[model samples]
Target: MDCYKKSNIEDLKAKNSYKIDLLDYSLFITFFPQLIAGPIVHHKEMMPQFHSLLNKEKALINWEFMAKGLFIFSIGLFKKVFIADSFAAWANAGFTLAQNGGTLNIFEAWVTSLSYTFQLYFDFSGYCDMAIGLALFFGIVLPINFNSPYKALNIADFWRRWHITLGRFLKDYLYIPLGGNRVSKIINLRNLFIVAFLSGVWHGAGWGFVIWGSLHAIAMVSHRIYSFLAIGKSFLNSKIYKIFAWLLTFNFLNIAWVFFRSENLSGAINILKAMFGITWVELPYKFKASWLFREIGGNDKMVGFILISFIICLCFRNSIQMLDNFKPNIKNSIIIMLFLYIALIMIGVTPYTEFIYFNF
Candidate 1:
């Protein structure tokens, strides 16, 4: 890739690209911070950093970078263990039930879907944050892979913010090669669906993934149509309309995550059946394990934590946004230490789980 990029330079004279040594290649391949899941990097992004490492090693001792990296890492750890894991407890149970053909009421189904929705949001974002913080520790700045995707008002906007590096890769390498938007609108829409299907295949070999991808393809296609249509051209001036749009997008995503997380298509549909109230079960069915707070805690604790998670996801600035304003200070150090300590204690060598993307 580096050689190709250099070869394409318009200049008549340019520095020739050298072959990377085997050891350097191996190091980059095994860069532990982002090996499993990535802000998928290219050689151009990393090689320069590696080549200049010795020159920068001395200056790397600057306190600000170290403090900032630790601060972000601490927050990521806290997010994964203290928050994502808490949500995972319910998500795992809910999915397990669905996979096993257990029936669910409206209450149970919503809980299950919403739990997995937030679980994936926090889990993947937390992993990306940890990766970024770790790379920063070594004076390597990774590409931002996640933003506050939940805050997006439309499917297109959500896609722009979610799994950003993956979207970038797909757009650059796949979509563009398929002719992108340079072609007729119909062909462009077709190209999008192709990319979406391939994106699902890239995740794993599952029909559920295919459906998940297809549903999103339909969504994006509809969004495009809406943008081009006469009715959609007219302004929706009221805040109510904006709120409605956000709600619609958010609920669509929450529902789509069912297929993304489910073990099988049938399991996903079963959950969806309950979600759509096809199986309403209005009489408040109670099992030995009620859906609301299954294995975690009391109803109040579940409600409180979930509400808090929503506030953080919907209202607070994301970690990356906060990182921009991070100034190393005694107060910041104390908070970082506290967060780190709790995460470490909670994990205690046998973590409740690993990062979900490691499977991908």
Candidate 2:
């Protein structure tokens, strides 16, 4: 509370504002739309809007903004209901198999990891979009939380794009306060480890989470070291190098996610063993005959869905980008409504599941 007050006062001072009543401050802090799992808004970004006459008028009646908000909300609903939930079953099954001391084949390992990847992305990003849309209905603009993080070329770039507000908070509060990059190389490395370790622990209380965070810290430190080397500098501008870097980063993140999703270190290791083909090359006949492998024609649908989702994630403009040129028209309205209808149907048919980050 003191920190928020201090920051708010500093922001107001910078803007040459003298007074903010308790009511306004209370409303700003307790805004329902982003109260949980925030795309953390600062006072400077929000407080002035409350004082603006235009926003005051829009709050009463704004048909265009309403339509836009509905469209965005529908998209988020579709992502959560249709996309994220679809993967949850498969993800759970695979993780369960690993937890039971069953060794997964390469195919099963990849499917499980990739399923959770897409599931987590769509689930969290979907919720963020819904929060943003709800806030927009009241003429409040929240910051964009998720970009195309899967398309990021490096770990640092990934952090910049994924859970952007959390990243910003950590950098501003934790990293900088710990003497970020202002000291010797050894000190900077220590700072990076501390931040990553805390970030891991923040997600959950488990050795798996700790290891996941440590893996990322090591990757980040290695990337930094590589950036300073002559060989890394020489390839900095190469297209092929950029492609390789992206692939490496993407795969590393996927691998690290095993730890994040697993119940323990053993489960994570089991998945990793299968992932790298250290377990077995061929599936057992009985296992192949089981419903798990035979269902849906042996994971073709899963692979196809994953491929399509990856393509869409890689090629499509993110929600924020789409909003940049947004103008609601009759055609777009119909499209959005159709999607909303389908999403509603899916929600009715599928069992209710909590958003993944709600656990965090």
Candidate 3:
């Protein structure tokens, strides 16, 4: 909070408004629902809203938006519980075993990586959807959280799309403050490293996260170098480039998750070693359903649920678009009924997991 307040003050000072009380930003930070998980609301976006809230009449509950919010929230809950929780188990197990220097094949490593990736996406995005839905019920338009980031063509574009608010916040508050791209070459390098280090720390209190942030900064800087040399632009516009970018982005994110998931620096090192096939010992048993239950983080049912849920999430945007355009006829009724049935099944079968973003 102090760092953020200092940053805010520095921003103000730059504009010759150093007289502003630092405590004035408290409301921006302490908005109850968003204090933990944030589509990190910026001072520029939030300050005006806070002033408006002061003069505002009591917010009326609009039943229509409330109902819609409930419906969306229900779906998000199901996704987090039924799907994301399942994958969380698998990812956790794989990570644990890998840390112990137990045997891990390429298939297992990649599957675990993919599972962690989807688990994060579902866990975070589900919460975001619920927050946005609830905000809409209260006549607020909360910012979008996750777009189809997997579809981005480059790392630069990927940052813009994924965790849109964080990227914007860092750009406005940290990056630009450190001279952005306008300073001397040496200063720019220093600022980039500083912002990335801060970004890592912002995510959590660990050096592993710091390394993860540094990796991303290095990637960004590398991309800039390539751009300056006019190397990848035309090629990057090609389909092959898009494919490579997607692969790179996903794998980069997956590797970072090892750091995010690990207990400490040594744990991160162990996981990274396993990822590189450095483990020399074999586990006592093979990867069977029963063995998975005994040794892994979660059950077969949970794994199945997560895999299926991920498939649905991958197609969710299309599903929502269909819902918006489809006419209210017999087909619609049948679809709604099916959805309701699935929701009920989820409620019965799934074990709940708190949304991952809650930590942030």
**Candidate whose lDDT is highest:** 2
Clashing residue pairs, backbone N/CA/C < 3 A, model 1: none
Q: Whole-model Cα lDDT per candidate?
A: 0.79, 0.80, 0.63
- The deviation in Å at residue 271 for candidate 2 is 0.9
Clashing pairs in 3: none
What overall lDDT, based on C-alpha atoms, would model 2 receive against the true structure?
A: 0.80
Ranking by lDDT: 2, 1, 3
Model 2 stretches astray by more than 4 angstroms: 1-21, 53-59, 231-234, 284-298
Expressed as tens digits, the lDDT of each residue in 173-272 for candidate 2 is 9999999999888888888878877889888888988998899899878877776667756677799988898899999999999999999778888989
TM-score of candidate 1 relative to the true fold: 0.88
State the lDDT at 296 in candidate 1.
27
lDDT of model 1, residue 321: 82
Question: Using Cα atoms with residue i matched to residue i, what is each candidate's TM-score against the true structure?
Answer: 0.88, 0.88, 0.75
| Candidate 3 total steric clashes | 0
Off by over 4 Å in 1: 1-19, 230-237, 280-282, 285-298, 349-351
Clashes of each: 0, 0, 0
Residue 237, model 2: lDDT of: 70
User: Per-residue CA lDDT of candidate 3, range 281-334, in tens?
Assistant: 353366765553444544466556656754564445622233235453566556
